[model samples]
Target: MAKAVLLILLSAYVITEMPQASWANRPEEAPKEKVTNLQFYFHDTLSGKNPTAVRVAQAPDSDKSPTLFGATFMVDDPLTETPDPNSRLLGRAQGLYGSSGKQEIGLIMAMSFCFVDGPYKDSTISLVGKNPAMNPVREMPIVGGTGLFRMARGYAIAQTHWLDPTTGDAIVGYNVTVFQ
Candidate 1:
């Protein structure tokens, strides 16, 4: 009988001393989400003294492939309210894109739009998708985000507002819809 009481006491102590990780902040349910629509422009500069994007690597056959397959570029482009680079600065789009299509110019983009202005300051939205360069418009997925955009899921429609054919510099307009 004494041994049974000691065992019960030990079990109670062990249960109370267990790690808190398994019990902390366990939400009973998901929070209601709000939908937001955002419009912005991304400036991808591949030329000039202060280019925002730079080629990082390429496959041996990248030069041979008209599509530049396997070529990768890291970018830190500016997000603006207008297609103009000098427009109101909204945020920065930082990430990497790689040429993945063998016959066509399909870019696998993985980037985050880090907002620096207004209510969304210090927040970010992550995007990942295949961008067909020749297409007039492309759609990308917003997988997730942080801060104000936590648990974000949505899509961004991209259209080339302007392109420098000779330099591959472009201003892409984005219309994004997000549920957070």
Candidate 2:
């Protein structure tokens, strides 16, 4: 009886230890898509100011004015670092409106990071926007600095101010897109 029990236990162990061909023979995963370019746009609605006027002349290539995406700014500032380390830029804005009455305006700034989709998916990029703030115009500093900023992987984006609420200016909106 003991011999039979031992034989049964050994068979069980062997079966459990055996590797399955299906698991071991699974196909390899596909390569990930690489992010190559980052595009940005800025717009303002304040009187006498054109937010689209903001330019990044030092960009790697000429800027594209896409009617669909508004105006585009090339992310090619020689001084700006690339592959943003934080993978994001702080968006900030401020405005002053009335000269003789109660001056009032809204402010909004947002930073976003792009990421790849799940496995077996198209190489589409998605952005995560956050840190949006709005308040009455005070004498506070905007929040962050721009120009020649450093990012991850030595990649950088050239940022320019298109509106200043403290000066009673109106800005439309800003857009940033990372290309693969």
Candidate 3:
């Protein structure tokens, strides 16, 4: 009985250690990961005939506050290849930003970068985070995307390229890196 049990155990161990036969033709491997870097500028026009960004909401005390602490604006700003308004059009940034800081111009942004031309045509990337308006450069997270940028994750660096003190219009540059 003991010998029979030992033989059974040995047989099991031998079978487990034996190399199994592989498929005659293995399927092709999945596509490799891709990392993409994109640069563009947003033409945020506030007080023009055809405004891209417009004030949607505001608090009673917002007017009194220097930073417009409780103001919110909806934007459909044009995305350009360069800071110049006449530069090649890339897409649009459609979303909203609100003043979150009481003492400074801290904006909470939730927007999508919708592409219309080039390799990213019909794709969109979502960005949501706090933007320190006064900072020379601010970084925000690239949460996710759709179409060509599906399952994307990365970061975006924004710098104010130009500002109109009178109209409060601005051209902001964006550098985005994405991995999928």
Candidate 4:
């Protein structure tokens, strides 16, 4: 009888531990599905300085938050009329803003923006574009004397106006995911 009781207890223990063991043995599940391609509008707040980091906001009313994505400073391409050295081809931009005291001039790739999908909040949407390169130039007039100059610091710039690839109209933001 004692053996029978022990067997029953052991069976329950085994059942209880089985799930954990199975989970441990199995590969970890992928992270929750997130919005992949998101478009953000860019506004050149600094005409002379290159933007380094981008702060994403849920809406035009929301506060801007930092993100992993970035942009670069480049002249607008004459052919495409888009920012040159596109983010799709070059990758994310690198460099620090405010280093030259003068804001950098050029386009940057920004990842910060917020959108709503159904009833769920979708802040995972990232800007899709090419990164830029660092361009060192002499300081401009205003901030130049103060040891400040406009430097292409290689940062992502969010667009204040983005042409929807689908509709081809200027859009502030768009939804990339669906909520349950």
Per-residue lDDT for 67 in model 1? 89
Which scores higher on lDDT, 2 or 4? 2
TM-score of 4: 0.25
Candidate 4 on 36-101: residue-level lDDT in tens? 222332222222244323333233322231221232223221111133323222122222222111
Model 2 segments more than 4 A misplaced = 1-30, 46-158, 161-180
Q: Once model 4 is optimally superposed onto the true structure by TM-score, how far is the C-alpha of residue 174 displaced, in angstroms?
A: 13
Stretches of candidate 4 exceeding 4 Å from the true structure: 1-18, 22-24, 28-35, 47-96, 100-111, 116-180
Task: Give the clashing residue pairs of candidate 1, or none.
Answer: none
TM for candidate 1 is: 0.83
List lDDT for all candidates, in order. Answer: 0.94, 0.29, 0.94, 0.28
Candidate 3, residue 9: Cα displacement in angstroms equals 17
In model 1, the worst 10-residue window by lDDT is 22-31
Query: Model 1, range 34-152, lDDT digits (tens) per residue?
Result: 99999999999999999999999999999799888999999999999998889999999999999999988899999999999978999999999999978998999999999999999
176 in model 4: Cα distance from truth in Å?
A: 11
* Displacement of the residue 138 alpha carbon in candidate 1, Å: 0.8
